[model samples]
Target: MCGLSADKIQVATGHVEISTITNHYIKTSSTYQKQLLELGNMDSINSLEVNKLKEIIMLQNQEILRLKERLNLENEEQTKNANLNGSKNEFKGVVA
Candidate 1:
């Protein structure tokens, strides 16, 4: 296990508060011991998971952009149709 102090661990992990890292993140007893033992392995796994999550977020953002563009196009078409219908109604009124 790394012999880092609580403050050092907080700084390294970018934790805003030492208590948060110690109290909430690092549980007590067997789980804590297991985490300490697999710290190096967990670091790699956590990094992989973070990268995967970022990729998923990027894909979701792209999908959202596409959907937004499609919605805008639909709205524009509807507006044009509405305006054309209004013009036809006005023409009929004028002719009568």
Candidate 2:
């Protein structure tokens, strides 16, 4: 299945020898082999999808941080403006 040689299969399966897989685990039937190959392909595809999702999550997290910083700066500016307005009102009252 999947065009891998017996030794390669043995290595992938963590068997010390190819005899274990050939004698017991693998089915020689065409349908079963095809299913195994399909499974291998799906594993590869799922890995790629998982990596892509991780990248998307990282980007969204960065955007959230940026937005939070922007909001914090806006709040600080508003607070400073409010304090300035309060001081001006106090000065006007004192002069009058």
- TM-scores, one per candidate: 0.56, 0.56
Global lDDT of each candidate = 0.84, 0.85
Q: Pick the candidate with the highest lDDT.
A: 2
Please write out the lDDT profile of model 2 over residues 19-92, one tens digit for every residue: 67775556576788898887777877788898999999999999999999999999999999999999999999
Candidate 1: lDDT of 19? 73
lDDT of 2 at 26: 61
Tens-digit lDDT string for candidate 1 (1-96): 156677777877898986777775556567877878877567777988889999999999999999999999999999999999999999999999
Off by over 4 Å in 1: 1-42
Angstrom error at residue 36, model 2? 18
The reply for model 2, stretches above 4 Å from the true place, is 1-42
Q: Report how far residue 75 has shifted in candidate 1, in Å.
A: 0.6
Candidate 2 clashing pairs, residues 3+ apart or interchain = none
